[model samples]
Each structure stands twice: as structure tokens, then as C-alpha cells.
Target chain A: MTTNKTVRLAQRPKGPVKPEDFDIREEDLADPGEGEIRVRNAFVSLDPAMRGWMNEGKSYVPPVGIGDVMRGFAAGQVEASRHPGFKEGDTVTGLLGVQNYAISDGKGVSLADTSLAPLQTWVGGLGMPGLTAYFGLLKVAEAKEGDTVVVSAASGAVGQVVGQIANIIGCRSVGIAGGPEKCDFIKSEFGFDAAVDYKAGNLFGDLKTACPDGIDVDFENVGGDIFDTVLAQMNPFGRIAVCGLISMYNATELPPGPKNLRNVLVMRLRMQGFIVFDFIKHNQEAMTALGGWYKDGKLKFKEDIRDGGVEAFPAVLSELYTGGNFGKLILKL
Target chain B: MTTNKTVRLAQRPKGPVKPEDFDIREEDLADPGEGEIRVRNAFVSLDPAMRGWMNEGKSYVPPVGIGDVMRGFAAGQVEASRHPGFKEGDTVTGLLGVQNYAISDGKGVSLADTSLAPLQTWVGGLGMPGLTAYFGLLKVAEAKEGDTVVVSAASGAVGQVVGQIANIIGCRSVGIAGGPEKCDFIKSEFGFDAAVDYKAGNLFGDLKTACPDGIDVDFENVGGDIFDTVLAQMNPFGRIAVCGLISMYNATELPPGPKNLRNVLVMRLRMQGFIVFDFIKHNQEAMTALGGWYKDGKLKFKEDIRDGGVEAFPAVLSELYTGGNFGKLILKL
Candidate 1:
């Protein structure tokens, strides 16, 4: 009998998560059933979407129930398999949980290389975050060459790729980061045309200076005041691709509304929000293009990995809400 | 010398317009300048946009100045012309003011015929309101077939035509009118799939029932509570054509905000607004298509004409703001 260490939900969180809300417990596992494989976990993904999964609502997916293992995307080495395609020591990624071991019935399970890019990198720029940036920016936003594009959370996993991809497409990309350090990283390190530090106390003024021709497309990761300010500055017929609303994810009450909604009328702007999972069918084409870009040195990746077992679930998940993670947030067991 | 009676802007109103705000005056006739033509006013358009024309701002056009004739669109006869294209007794439509006689530079002019449709019908479906409905619904919303489309102010000038066009394009068209009379008019006269009275309470609930398939395209002319309610009922990737905000145009203060803006995040909806004046270049092709539809009997047109002299300006303009006009609002001088 194998004992599995799993991070289980002990209590529902009120606002930001507390350590006591999770309990890392050891549980005995049964033998793998027919057509099922038993895998030992190597890495688990921590993302901003996990915050929505923790709460009960009508979102893209169902919420994680109390007493259940924390829901996550994980990669692991196959220890045993009764399925046709599986073999011993094969590495795979799937919607596994925050645990040392998991059983899968071959649905959405795919083999991955831990050598080309770290297992954590796949959780970020090479994986979900990468595809999210690619499809949302190019397809949803319909970004074209010579367009002036703006992205929020510039140094984060998705924002980093969005700006770089815009650059590759011959567009001028402006990024919105939180501080001077991240702003410098996007401009110098990530090759963004310009980066705005929102916390610098002159958001609109700085944004005005950075975007001289007016924003043609805005990849909106931050909502609330930032959204309102950007709405006022958008050019006529501009498009907004809203991938996340991290600014209002943990709000106890609804944030005050966009008062300058008249600008939406005057400028004729198109603002759209999307969940990345909807692009699952475009996986092969998306990854192939991203992989080609990576190999050609046209794309870059970043991973903010936390080394710990299932015990770090609560803390790692909270880091996304608090903006503690610089890139894709991941935990390795 | 013949005297021309006209309605002039005596003062700008603070909130709702009053009778004293207009001056009934008689002015001497002036000959048309070079390349200009003189038109004797037959019909003057009364629109909610006139409210914005009273204020000094950078909109689609200049504001109506104090002591000037209230700026508007009108259809009349070319009693005299200094231009080659126009001649004496030719029926024409141009941006003539609320007056018995006006001179135009022939900068903008259209020939109107009652045999093609009624004189009022041209103003509503074949004219400005028609172009507003046609371009805003098709070009701005990018509305497609099999989409579920909903429109606010359903019995008004723009809303009625938007629903009819959505229906003709294989979309399920739903309308939000003010009363049972208008609701019936939207369903029976306009051939809309369904109608809802938002003022009957439970605005959001009514929208939900009216559009069970979920709203794919929302033509937003009345903002405030209607916009708040529509935001919640949108389907994933829904498109909103934000045309006007007649509800809040006269309000002294900003109305209370929407409650569920986070829906913009969860559903990935798009909202945009525009003015028809910006699309003058598309006039030839647009009117040709509209004329084809009209000739095929695939579309219907309606107008509500209130006849009087310059004394009718205050009463006619007031009807537009109060949901009192059944189709298009027009003042025949």
C-alpha cells in the first residue's frame, strides 16, 4: 500500500486564503483499476484561476468542494499502468490534484518533456499561460501589425508572452506592471516597447505618454480603476481582450463602476473577456507555433517555482492574488 | 421681403428643457452663396442627440450656439439654387434648422421621394434613423446569422429597424419597449420574435425570459438600468452595439451603477458604441442595400409626424425624450 500526501481543503476562505484553510494529510491509496494508471506527482500548477475554483459559482468549471483535494494541473511519472499507451516511468500532465500520487483514466492526459523546459515552465509560458496569451491576443483581440497594443501585469506569465508576440507581429506593445523593477524587466528583458508602472501614482498621465497614437488593443488583466482609466484613453474602434480581472477577484464588495462609460459611446471601443480553456481545440496549432517560436529564439519563457510538497498549497495559491509571483506560479513536490 | 418664422435657442437648459428656452422669431431671407442652395423647410427631425447639441463639447459635430437657430435635419424644396446639381422645385433633404426657410452650401444633401417611401419614412428607415439602425446593427455590432439579438427602446426610431434587420438575417430578435402598446407594436408591426416591458419591474428577469437562448447581440440605445440588466444576460462572446444613452442624457447627476459587471469577465462579452455621422462614406452602398430590402418587401418603415409652426419645437423635442414617439419623431413646418 502506498501512502499519498495530499493538500485537502479544510475550510472555505473568506477573503485572501489563510494557512489554516488547508490540511496536508496522508491517505492510503487502492490499486489502480482497469484502464487506469497510477502516477507519482512531480509538479503542480498554482494559478489565478484557482481562486475562482475555490469559490462556489457558475464559472467556466465547477468549484472544488470542501474536504476534496485542491484542484490543480500537475505532471508526474507513471509508476504503474493497465492502459494500452502507458508504460513505466513515462512522464505526463493532466488535471491531477495537489498530491504525491494520482490515478487517471486517460482523458486529457498527454506526455510531456521535463528536459526541454522545466515541468514548471509548461505550467506557465510553455503550457496554459502560453496558449492563453497566444490565442487571446491574436484571435480574440484580432491584433494586427502596426497596432498599438497594451497589456496589464506585464512581467507576469501571460503578459510577458503577449507583449513579445505583439512585437513579433510588428505591433508596438506597451505593458502595465506594478513597479519600476517589473517595468524595467518588460522593457529591457522582455523587449516591450514601453512599460507603465501603475503603482507609480500617474497611471493615466504615464499611459498617455507611453501610448502616443492611442491604444488600439488592450489585453485587460487588471479591472477596476485601471480598466476605467484605459476605457477613457482607448482609440475609436479599439478592441479590448479581457483575460482576467485580478483586481476584483478578492473584493468583498463590488468595485465602484466605470464612471466614464460615455467614452465607450464616443470612441466605439470593443471590450471582451474570455477563459483560456475554451481554446482547448486549438491546442496542437497553438503549441506547435509557440514551440517553433521558442526554438527559433523568437519566444521566451519564465517560471516562478516554489519547492515544497503538498504542504505549500494555500500559500502558493495566495501568492497569485497578492502579486507575489513574478511569472507563472508553480510548486514542485 | 418675405419673413421666415423659426425656433432659435434662447438659452441652454440645465436639466429638462422649458418653453422659455426657445424663442419664436421672424428673420429676413438671405440669398444662397456660391455653390449653395436655398431650401424651404417641410420637415424637421427631433432627436435625443439634440440634447448634446445644446452643450459645448467635441462630439460628432459642433454644439448649437445660443441665439442661433436650433440645428437639425430637414427635408424641403429647392426653391432657389446657385449650384448645378440642384435646381428650382427639386425636393431635397439636408441639415436645415427648425425654420421655414434656410440656405445650405450643398455640403450634405439627399433627394427625398414619398413614392419610394413616405417623407417621414425616409427620415426614419431610409434616412438618419435608418442609417443609424443599419450601420450600428450590422457594421458596429458585427451581428451574424443564428445569433440571438436584443434591443432596448424597441418601438423607437432605431430599435424597431434593428430588430427587423436582425430577424431578416436569421437572428432571433427580442425587443425591450416601455408599455404593452409598444411591445405589441414591436412584435406585430416590426415582426420581432418577442418583446419585454422593462418598466414592469424585474428588468433582468424579463430579459432572461425574453432571450432564453442568451443574448448574442445587444443594440444599446437606452443606457443606465437597461445597460446594467443587459450586461448580466449576455452570452459568451456576446456583442453590444452601444449607440446612445437617452435615459441619462438629461440627468443632472450620474445614475447609480451596474451591479454585475463581473459578467464581462465570466462570459467574454464585447460592448462597443458608435455614431452614424462617422460613416458617411458608406452611404451609397448602405442605402442601395436598404433600398433593395424595401423593394423586396422584406422590411417595414414607420414614422410619427407632429405638424405645426416654430411653436411646435419645444413640444416635439420633448416627445423624443419621454418615449412618446411611436416611430420616428418629426416636425413639419
Candidate 2:
């Protein structure tokens, strides 16, 4: 019998998640069922959306119940398999929770290719974050060639992919990041047209200069001031794909909505909020297109990996809100 | 040459429009040019949108310049014409401003049909407000048969029309009005499935009770509390057509946006803001459809015609915000 180290939700979070909100425990793992596969998670994804799942309320997905293993996405090698399609040693990715091993009935489990990309990249560029940017920019925002695309949290997992994809498709990409380091990286490494450092206190002015022709597509991740600023610079018939509102995920009370909402009427803008799961049926199509871009060297990504096993789950997740993580955050068990 | 009594913008309103903000002046009317027609204004349309045009900012249309005639829509008779498309005694409707007489070069002037509907009905049911409800509900909201449609300001021009049209197309319509009388009118006269009086102090509870199946389409006219409340009851993949924000038009300072905007993502709601002019090319189509509904007795309308002529424009316009007017508020010139 294998002893699995797992992090479980101890209680619902009040605001910023405290370490006490989660509990680390060791449990015996049962053998795979007749048609199930056992996965030993190599890398668990730490995302801003995790903060939302910890709260007690309605959302795109249900809240993680107390005493349950913290829900998350992970990429790993299949350790044992009773399923005909998946075999031992096959690389797979699925919602494996924050644990050492996960047993699945093969639902939502996909075979991953490490030959084309690294293990971490499967949870980074070719994972949920990558697909979010792919479908959000191309399908949701309907971004076309020569369009000016502006994205917030440009150094984060999804925003970075959004900026790079915009560039690959012949659009001018402008990124808004928290620090000078992220801003510089987005411009130099990611090949963004312009990068605005929001921490510089000149976000509005900097954004104005970066997008002179006005933002045609706004890929919103961090809502609040960033959303309000970008909204004012949106062109007529602009499209805003509200992917995430990380800034408000941990708030005890929601802040007022964007004051410039009237701009939607005046500019005839279409603003929609979407979840990646809504486009789950089209995952293969998105992965194929994004995988081609990755092979062509037209896409670049960075992973912020933390090594502390299951006990580090709560602490590492905090890095998303604190701006401590520079890239796609992952946990190496 | 004839003398025209016109209401001009004396100064921009700081909040709720003051009578002092307008200046009524007598001016000599210009003769019709080679291709111009002279219209003797019979009924001037007073709308919530006119309040927005008085503010000094960017909007769907430019602000009414100081000392310029207050912009409005009117249905009147063409007394003289040098234009081939129009002649004497022809009823017409256009942006004729707040004046007794208007001269146009035959642009945007549409011949009004008083044969199928009354003259004032042209401004009430076949005018901009009627077309606004038609296109906003069908085209923008994409309301289909069996969809639960909720419209704010249910007793007002656009709102009433929206409810009636939703019913005509086999959709269940719910209306939100201010008083018990208005609420009763919407249910009894307009054939709404349910009506909630926002002034009843149980707005949230009443709305939840009324919309048991959840709102599929929200035709928003009045913003603020009404908008925020309806937003919460929206079902998954709901559509919100932001036709007007009358609640915010007269606000001295813009109020905080709806806090539950995150529902947009969780519910996968598509919220779009649109101006009627965006569908100008389809006016004939919209009018023809709405007119057919009216002739079949399937659509009924009531006009709150204020007999105060052009000088009473400012006072009558205030009735919209105060809920003093019961139906389509129009100034009988």
C-alpha cells in the first residue's frame, strides 16, 4: 500500500487564505479499480482561481468542501492502470487534486506529450492556462490581424499566453504587468509591442501611450483599476473577454463595478465572461493550434515552480495574489 | 418666413435638469432650400435618452452644444417641401429638435403612417422608442420563444413595448415598474406574466418570486438597484441588452457599478450595450414588424401626451425620472 501525502481544506477562507485553512495529512491509497488509472502527480498547478474555490459561495465550479483534498490540476506519469486506453508510464494530465496520487475513471484525463514540451509545460502552455488564452483571444475576443490587444497580468500564466498569441497572429499586443521586471520580460522575451508597469503609478497614462489606436480586444484577468483603465481606452465595437477577476477573488466584499460601464453602450462594445470548461468540447482543436505555435517557436512560457510537497499548497497559492510568482506557478512534490 | 419657438440649452445640468438650464427663445425660421422640407412639429418625444445628451461627455451621440436647440425626436406634418420624397400634409418623424418648426434637407426624415396607427402612435409605437424595444429584445437580446424576458421601467415607452413584443413572440415577459399602478398596468394591460414594483421595498424578494424559472433575457433601461437586482436572478447563458441607463443619466456622480458583475462569468452571461442608431439600416424592417403586430391587435400602447407645447420640455422630461409619467411621455406641441 502506498502512503499518499495530501492537503485537504480545513475551513472556508474569510479573505486571504490563511495556512490554517488547509490541513496536511498522510493517507493510504487504494489500488486502481477495474477501469480506473492511478496517477502519481509530478506537478500540481497553483492558480488564482483556487482562491475562489476556497470560498463558500456559488461560482463556475462548486466550492471545495472541508476535509476534501484541495482541488487542482496536475500532470504526472500513470503509475497503475486498469483502463484499456491508458497504460503505466504514460504521461497524463487531469484535475488530480493537491495530493501525491490521484485515481480516476479516465474522465477528463488526457494523454500528455513530453517529447514536444517539458512536463511543467504541459501544466503551463499546453494546459488550462494555455487553452484559456487560445480560446479567449481567438474565439471569445475574435481578435483579428492588425487589432490592438491589451491584456492585464501579462506575466501570469494566462496573460503571457494571450500576449504571445496576439503577436503570433499579426496583432499588436500590449501587456499590463505589476512590476518593472515583468514589464521588461513581456516586451523582450514575449515580444509584446508595449508593456505597461502598473506598479509605476502611471497606469492610465502608460496605457494611453501604449494603445494609441485604442484597445480592440481586452483580455481581462485582474479586474478593478486595471479593468476600468482599459475600458476607457477601448475602441468602438471593442470586445472584452472576462477570463478572471483575481483581484476580487479574495475580497470579503466586492468593490464597485467598473464605473465606465456606460462605455459599453456608447462604444457598442460586447463584454462577456467565459470559463474554459464552456469550451471543453473544443479542447482538441485548441490544443492542436496552440501545440503548432509552440513547436514553431512562436510561443514562449515560464514556470514558477515551488518545491515543498503537499504542505506547501496554501503558502504557494498565496504567491498568485502577492505577485511573488513570476510565471505559471507549479508545485513539485 | 415664420417665427419658431425653440428651447435652447442655456447651460449643462449638474444633476437633475433644472428649468433654468434651458432658454426658450423665438427665432426666424429659415426658408426651405431647393431640396429642403419644412416640418410643423405636432408632437415632440420626451425620452430618458435626451437627459444623457445634456451632459458634457462622450456618449453614443455628441452633447448638445450650449445655445443650440435641445435635441429630440418629433412626429409632425410637412407644411412645405422642395424635396421629391416629401410634400405638403405628409406626416414625418425625425430628430427635429425641441422646436415648433424644423427645416431639413430630406435626410433621415421618414414618412409617418397615421392610417394604420394614430399620428402620436407614430412617435409612440412606431418611433425610436418602439424600434428600440423591438431591435433590443429580438436582435440584441436574441430572445426566442419560451425565453423568460425581464425588462426594467416596464410602464415606460421602451419597456412597455419590450414586454408586449416578448409576449407576441411566444416568450414569457416579466416587468419591473415603480408603483403598484404601473405594476398592475403591466400585468393587466401589457400581458406580462408577472410584475414587480421596485418601490414596494421588497424588490429583491418580489423579483425572485416573479422570475421562478430565472431570467433568460434582461432588457435593461433603468440601471442602478434595479439592474443589480435583476443581474443576480439571471440564468446560465442569459443575455442582457443594455438599452438605456435612465437611473444613472441624472446622477450628479456616477454610482458604483453593480457589485455582482462576477455573475457574468459564473452564469456565462453575455451583456452588451447598444444604441438604436447602430441598427439604422434595419429601421424599415423593425418598423414593418412592429407595425404588423400593432395592426393585428396583438400589441397595445398608451401615450402620456403632456399638453404643454415646446416650452414645457424641461418640466415634462423630468417626469421620466420622477416616475410621474405613466406611459410614453410626449409633448403635444
Candidate 3:
């Protein structure tokens, strides 16, 4: 028998997730079942969506139950397998939770390739965030050449991919991110046409300057003031793909939605909310296209990997809410 | 020359429009110029959209500038014409403004046929409201057979047509109106599947009971609480054709949008706002279909004709905001 160290949800978070809300535990692992494989997690992804999973409510996915292993996505190599598909030493990625080891039945598990990119990139750019930006901008928003696409959290995982992909597709990409450094990184590293520092006092003014032709597509990640301001700048028949509302995830009560929603009518806008899981069947198509872009030197990615192992999961997760993570956040176990 | 009694926008209303906000005056009407025709207005349409036109801001149409005739839709007889398309004694409908006589260039002027429906019906059922309902339900909301559609402001012009058209297309139609009388009319007269009186309290509970299968299409006319309640009960991949938001028109400041907008993502809802004018090119198709429905007695309409001529435009327009008028509100000159 082996010991598996994991983080468990101790209580449902009322507002921002606190360290006390989770309890770290060591449990004896049973041998894999007939159809299950054991994975030794190399890197666990820390996402804004985790904040939503910690709450007790109905969402796109079920909330993490109390005393259960905290739900998360991780990239790792197979340690032991009784499953027919996954063998020992095969790199795989799936919802493996915030732990050193995970047992899976090969339901959502996918083969991870680190030949072109690093193992951590599989849990960052080439993972859920990449697929989200791909399907969201192309399918949901229907972004086309000559369209002006605006992305919030522009230097982060999904936003970086969204802006870079928009550029590759012949559209003008404008990014909105916190701090001057993140903004500069989006324009210089991601090749976005422009970047606005939302943390600066002149967000609306900077947005107006960035999108002089008016925003045609809005890839919304952060909700609240940023969402509202971007909405005001949308052109007629604008398409908004609402991927996440990270700003509102930690609120104790329902926050007021965009007051300028009246523009949805006046400007004849189409606003839709979508979960990346909905496009699971089309993952191959997204992977093929994104991989091509990556190999062609058109797509670039950065990771903010922390090396404190599973014990640092609670403190590191809060960094996402505070905008402390500079890129795709990952925990190295 | 003829003396035309007109209602002009005196000042932009701060909140709900008042009599002081408009000036009722008599001006000498100019004769029809080259290719122009003059129409003697018999009935002027009083639509909730007119309230939006009163504001000094950009909308689907330009605002009615202060000191200019308050823009409106009217049906009347052509008194004089120099245009080959129109002649004296011809019944016509167009944007004739809130006045006794209007000089036009025959642009957008449609010949009214009162053989089956009344002349005022040209500006009501067979006009912008009817077109809005037809396109909104069929095209925007994409209501198909067996789909459950919920319409707000069910007794009003657009709502009545929306519910009835949904039923005609083999979809289940449910209505949310203000009072018991309006609610009863929707069921008894309009042939709706069910009606919920929003003013009777138990809005959320009643909506749940009414839409047990969950709303697939939401023909949203009245926003605010009604919109929020209906949103909570929407099914996955639901479509919302936002026709109007009359409840928010009179507010001095922007009211909070639906707090449950997060459902847009969880349920993968598609919400689009559209203007009737955007479908103007397809007006003939809509008119032909709606007129056929009217002549076949498959669609019935009632008008809340308010007398006191154009002078009463200020007071009568308020009736729409107050829910005092039933059916299609029209002001007879």
C-alpha cells in the first residue's frame, strides 16, 4: 500500500476561498481496480473556475463535496495500471484533483505529448484554456478576419491564447490585463495589436483608445466592471462569448450584472455563455488546429508554475483571485 | 397650406415623460414637394417604443430631437400627392409623426388594405409590432414545433402576437401579464397555453408551475423582475429574443440587470436583442403571412383606441407605462 497526499474540502466557502476551508490529508491508496489506472501527478492546474467548484450551488459542474478530494485538472504519468488503454509511464491529462496521485477509469483522460512543449504546458496553454479560447472565439463568437476582438485577463491562460489566435486568424486583437507588465507582455509576446492596463485608473478611456473601430467580438473572462465597460464599447451586432465570471465567483451574494445590457438590444448584440466541456467531442479538431499554430511559431505560451508541492495548494489557489499569477497557474507536485 | 396640430419634444424627459416635456402647437403644413405626398392622419400609433425615442441618446433610430415633431407611426388617408405611387383617397401607413398631417416622399409608405382588417390595424397588428413578433419568435428565438415559449407583457401588442404566433407554429405559448384581466384575455382570447399574472405575487412559483418543462424560447418585452424570474426557469440551449424592455424605459437611472445572468453560461442560453427596423426589408413577407392569418380568422386582435386626438398623446402614452391600456394602444386623431 502507498500513501497519497491530497487536499479535501473542509467547508463550503462563503466568499473568497480561505485556507481553513480546506484540510490536507494523507490516505492509504488501494490498488487500482480492474479498469482503473493510477497516475503520479506532475503538474496540477490552478484555475479561476476552482473558486466556483468550492461553492455549494448548481453550476456547469457539480460543487466539490465536503471531505472529498478538491476537484482540479492535472497532467501526469501513469504509475500503475490495470486498465487496457493506459499503460505504465504514459503521460496523461484529466481532472485528477489537487493530489500527488489519482485513479481514473479512462473516461476523460487524454494522452499528453511533451515532445513539442513542456509537461506543464499540457496543463496550461495546450490544455483546457487553449481549447476554451479556440472554440469560444471561432465557434461561439464567430470571429472572422477584420473583426476587432477584445479579451479580458489578456495575459492569463485563456486570454493569451484568445488574443494570439485572433491575430493568427487575421483579426485585430486587443487585450485587457492588470498591471503594465502583463499588458506589455500581451502586446510584445502574444502579438496582440494593443493592450490596456485595466488596473490603471483610466480603464474605459484606455479601452476606447485600444478599440478605435469598436469591438466586434468580446471574449469575457472577468465579469463586473471590466465586463460592463467592454459592453459599452461593443459595435452593432457584436458577439460576446462569456467564458467565465472570475470576478464574481467569490462574491457572497449575487453581484449586479452589466447595467449597459440595454445595449444588447440597441446594438443588436448576441451574448452567449458556454462551458468548454460542451465541445469535448470536438477536442481533436481544436488540438490539431492549435498544435499546428504552435508548431508554426504563431502561438506562444507562458506558465506560472509554483514548486511547493500539494501542501501549497490552498495558499497558491488564492493567488489567482488576487491576480498574482502572471500566466497559466500550475502547482508542481 | 393647412394648419397641422403637432406634438413636439420640448425637453428630454428626466424619467417618465410629462405633459411639460412636449409642446402642443399648430403650424402651417408645407405642401407636398416634387415626388412628395401629404397624408391627413386619422389614427396615430402610441407604442412603448415612442418612449425610447423621447430620450436624447442613440438607439435603433435617432432620438426625436427637441423642438422637432415627436416621431411616430400612423395610418391615414392621402389628401394630396405628386408622387406616381400615391394619390388622393388612398389609405397609407408610414412614420407620419404625432401630428394631424404629414408630408412624405412616399418612402416607406405602404398602401393600407382595410377590406379584411381595420385601417388602424395596419399600424398595430400588421405594422412594426406584428413584424417584431413574427420575426422575433420565428427567426430570432427560432421557436420550432413543440417548443415551450414564454412571452412577457402578454396582453400588449407585440406580446399578444408573439404568443399567438408561437401557438400557430405548433409551439406551446405561455404569457406573463400584469393583472388578472390581462391574464384571462391571453388565455381566452389569444389562446395561450397558460397565463401567469405577475402582479398577483408568487411570480417565481407561478412561473415554475407554468413552465414545468422549462422555457425554450423567451419573447422578452418587459424586463426587470419578470425577465429575471423567467431566466431562472430557462432550459438548456434556450433562446431569448429581446424585443423590448418597457419596464426599464421610465427609469431615471440604469436599473440592475438580471442577477441570474450566470445561468446564461450554465444553461448555454443565447440571448439576442433585435430592432424591428432591422427587419424592414423583410416587411412584405411578414405582412403577407400575418395578413393571411388575420383574414383566415386564425389570428384575432383588439385595439385600445384612446380619443382626445393628438393633444392627448402625452397622457395616453403614459397608459402604456401604467398598464392602463389593453391590447394595441392607438390614439385616434
Candidate 4:
């Protein structure tokens, strides 16, 4: 008999996530039932959106219920399969939960081609984060050639992909990251047009310097002061794609909105909020474009894969909010 | 020799318009030049945007310069003309300043068809305010059949027309006003489906009760707390046309933005700011529709024409920021 190790939600978080909010347990593993497939999850993806999913109340998606396996996206090889579509030894990825083993009926499961990249890559750039950037920048913001695109949280998974895609589409991509190190990495490694180090305490001026002609498209990930500064610099008829507000995710109380929101009126700007799940119908088109870019050397992804198995889930997940993770955060079971 | 009584901007207003801020004086009026036409103005329009124009910063339009004729829109007959486009007794309306007489070269001038409505109505509903409501509701917000459209400052010039137009287009129109009298007037006089009295001290609950299926479109005229409540009640894929922020215009300092702005993302809402000038190309189409509705008795306009000349401009204009006017506040010269 084998044992499956899993992390379950114990309670709702108050502010920042704490380890006591989750329960790590081991249970007896069962074989695949009728039309079911068993995946031994190799890598579980960590996202800022996970923090929102743990809260109580209505959100883009339902909250992670207490005592249930924590909701997450994972990539792994199938150990057993009773379904005809997926067979043993097949690599797949989906919302398979934060567990050593996941059972699925193949509803949202997608086959991962390992010849293109590793399992961690499948759960990183080529996965939800990559697709988020693809749809948000192209479809929502409608960033065009010769446009100046700005993105916040530039070193994170989705932000990095967004900047790269903007450059590929002939836009001047300016990234906003926390420290000098991450800022330098985005410009040097990711080939971004410019990087504004937000930790330098000159956000408004630095952003103005980076975007001389004013911002045409903004893929806003971080909310609060960062968003306010971007709002002030937006050109007439600019588009803002509100993909995430990670800065407000863990707030115990609701914070005041951007003071420069008046810019939305005076500048005739269009601001729309969107989730990657909202664009599920266009997944195939997005994946084809993203995968093509990845294969042609136009795209690259960095993974911060950690050890200590599923037991390190809480600690590794908390690193994302603290800016401790340098790239696409993932846990190797 | 005729005399022209004009109101010139003495200095930039700090919080609200004061009588001392304007230098109302009479000067010897000159005859029409080679291409200029002199208009004997009868009615001047008052708008919330005028307050923004009084500041010393950038806005949709340049600030009204100190010692210059205070910028305004007015309707009158051409008393004398040397321009080919104009003849004597021709009724017109344009950005003709706040004075008893105006000189124009026929640029941006729109001929008023008094046969359709009165001169006050031209500046009130058939002029900028009407076009604003037309483009803001249909073009900017895209309010269609079955949409629950909400507008703030319900009894004001643009807001009344917005509600009436929504009803004409087969939408459920809801208006937000301050007092009970204004709220009841919107529903009974302007034919709004419902009215939410913001001064009733139960804005959130009242708005929820009025919008049973959730708000689908919001024509935001008043920003601040009223905007925050409507934002919270918005349904998925809702559209918000930010036509005006009357509540914030007279604010002495920058106020915190809507606390519930996060709803824009969670509900996948689209909030766009627009000015009537941005849609000038579509003016003919909008006017044809609005005029047809007005002629068919399906559209109604309420003008609070104050019996005051250009000298009363400062006091009458102050009434707008305080919500003292019951309807479209226009000054009769």
C-alpha cells in the first residue's frame, strides 16, 4: 500500500498567509476508478491568485473549502489510467490540487509535450501564467505595434511573459519590478525595453522617464500606488488591462483606491478587468501562439522550483507575496 | 454704439466659484469685421465641466485664462454678420463666451432649429447636454435592451436625458439624486424606472433593492461614494460611461477614489471615460435620433432657467456644485 501526501485548507487567512491555515496530511492511495486517471504530480504551480482563492466570499472563482485539498495547477506524468483518452506514462497538466497524487476525469486536462520543455516549464510560462499574458496584452489591452506597453510586478511569472510578448509584437515594453536586481534581470535577460525599480522610491519620475511618449497599454498586476502612477501617465485613449491586484490580495481591510482614478475620466481611458479563466474559449489560439514563440526561441521561461515535497507547500507559497521568489514559483514533489 | 456686458475671469478659483473671482464689466461693442459675426446672446449654458476649466492645470480643455472672457456655450441670433456662413437673425449656439454679445468667425458654430425646441432647450437638451447623453449612453456605454442603466445627478441636464433615452431604448433606467423631491421628479417627470435618493442614508441597500437583477450599465455623472455603491452592484461584463465627476469637481483637495473599485476586476466590468467632443463626428447621427425622439414626444427636457444676466453668472454657477438647481441650470441673459 502506498501513501499520498496532500495539503488541505484548514481555515481562512486573515492578512498574509500563515502555515497554520493549512493541514498537511498523509492518506492511503487508491487506484484509478472507471474513466479516471491518476497523476503523480511532479510540480505544483504557485500563483498570487491562490491567495484570493483562499478568501471567503465571491471572487473570480470559488474559495478553497476548508478540509479540502488546496486548489492549484500541477504538471506530472500519469501513473495509471482507466480512461481511453489518457494512457500510462502520459504527461499532463491541469487544476490537479496541491497533492502528491491527483485523480482526474480528464475534464480540463491537457497533454504536456516534454520534448518542447520540462514539466516545470509546462506549469510555468507555457501554462496559466503564459496564457494570461497572451490574452491580457493582445485581446484585452489590444496593444499594437509602436505602442508603449507598461507592466507592473515585472519579475513575476505573468509579468515577465507579458513584457516579452509585447516586445515580440513590436511594442516598447517597460517593466516595473521591486529591487535593482530584478529590474536589471528583466532588462538584461528578458530583453525588456526598460525596467523601473519601484524600490528606488521615485516611481512617478522613473515611470515618466521610461515612458517618454506616455503609456498606451498597461497590463496592471500590482494595484495601489503603482497603478495610480501609471494612471497619471496614460495617454489619451489608453487601455488598461486589470489582470491582477496582488498588492491588495492579503489586506485584512479594503484599501483606498487609486487617487489618480480621475485620469480615467480626463484622459478618456478605457480600463477593463479580466481573468484568464474568462478567456477559456480562446485557449487553443493562445497556446498555439505561445508554444510557437517558445519553439522559435522568441520566448523563454525561468522556474524557481523548490524541494521538501508537499510539506513545504505553505512556506514556498508565502514566498510569492514577500517577493522572495525570483521567477515562476514551483514546488517539486 | 452698443455696449457688451461680459464676465472675465479675475483669478483662478480655489474651491468654489465666488463673486469676486469674476470681473463683470460693460465695454463698447465693436461691429463685425471682414469675416466676424456679432451674436446677441440670449441664454448661456452652465455645466459641471466649467468648474474643472477654472483650475490652473491640464484637463480635457485648457483652463479658462485669468482676465479672459470666461468660456461658455450660448444660444442667440446673429445681429450682424460679415461671414458668408451667417446672415442676420440666424439662430445659433456654440462656445460663445458668457456675455450679452459674442463675436465669432463661424467656427464650431451649430445652427439652432428653434422650430424643434426653444433657445433655452437648445442649450439645455438639444445642445451639448443632449449630445452628451446621446453619445455617452449609446456610443460610450452601449446601453441596449434589457440593460439596467443607472445615472447619477438624476435631475440634472445630462442625467435627465440619459434616463429618458435609456427608457426609449427599452432599458430599465434608474437615477440617483440627493433629496426626495429630486428623486421623485426623476421618476415622475423624466420617466426613470426607479430612483435612489442618495441623501436618504441607505445608498447601498437602496441601490441593491432598485436593481434586482444587478446593474448592467452605469452612466456615472457624480463620482465619490455614489460611484462606489453603483460599482459594487454592477453585474458581470457591465459597462460604465464616465461622463462627469460632479462630486469631485469642487473638492479642495484630492479625495480617495472609490473603495469598491476592485469590483471592476471581479465582475469583469469595463469603465471608460469620454467627452462629448470625442464623438463630434457622430453628432449628426445622434442629433437625428435625439430630435426624432423629441419630436415624437418620447423624449422630454427640463430646464431650470434662472432669470439672471451675465452679472449673475458667478452665483448661478455656484448653485450647480451645491445641487441647488432642480434641473438643467441655464442662465437667461
Worst 10 residues of 3 chain B by lDDT: B279-288
**Backbone clash numbers for all candidates listed:** 1, 0, 0, 0
Q: Judged by lDDT against the true structure, how good is candidate 2? A: 0.88
RMSD of each: 6.0, 5.0, 5.7, 5.1
Scored by Cα lDDT, where does model 4 land?
A: 0.90
- Worst 10-residue lDDT window, candidate 4 chain A: A279-288
Which residue runs does candidate 2 get wrong by more than 4 Å? Answer: A1-44, A54-56, A64-71, A75-119, A305-325, A331-333, B1-44, B54-57, B64-116, B305-326, B330-333
- Candidate 4, which CAPRI tier? medium
Rounded to one decimal, what is candidate 2's iRMSD?
1.1
| Candidate 4 lDDT tens digits, B116-189 | 77778778888788999999999989999999999998888889999999999999999999899989988998
Q: Per-residue lDDT for A1-333 in model 2, tens only? A: 889999999999877888999999999999999999999999998887888788887678889999999998899999999999899999988788899999999887887777767777778777889989988998889999999999998987888899999998999999999888888988999899999999999989999999989999999998888898899899988999989887786688877888888777779888888988788777767877777788888888888889998888888888788878877888887
What TM-score, to 2 decimals, does candidate 4 have?
0.81
Residue B67 shift from truth in candidate 3, angstroms: 7.5
Candidate order, lDDT descending: 4, 3, 2, 1
- Candidate 3: the clashing residue pairs are none
Would you estimate the TM-scores of all the predictions? 0.76, 0.81, 0.78, 0.81
DockQ of each: 0.43, 0.60, 0.62, 0.65
After TM-score superposition, the amount by which residue B49's alpha carbon in candidate 1 deviates from its true location, in angstroms, is: 2.6
Better of 1 and 2 by TM-score: 2
Write one digit per residue (lDDT tens) for candidate 3, span A111-180: 7766656778778898889989999999999999999999998887899999999999999999999899
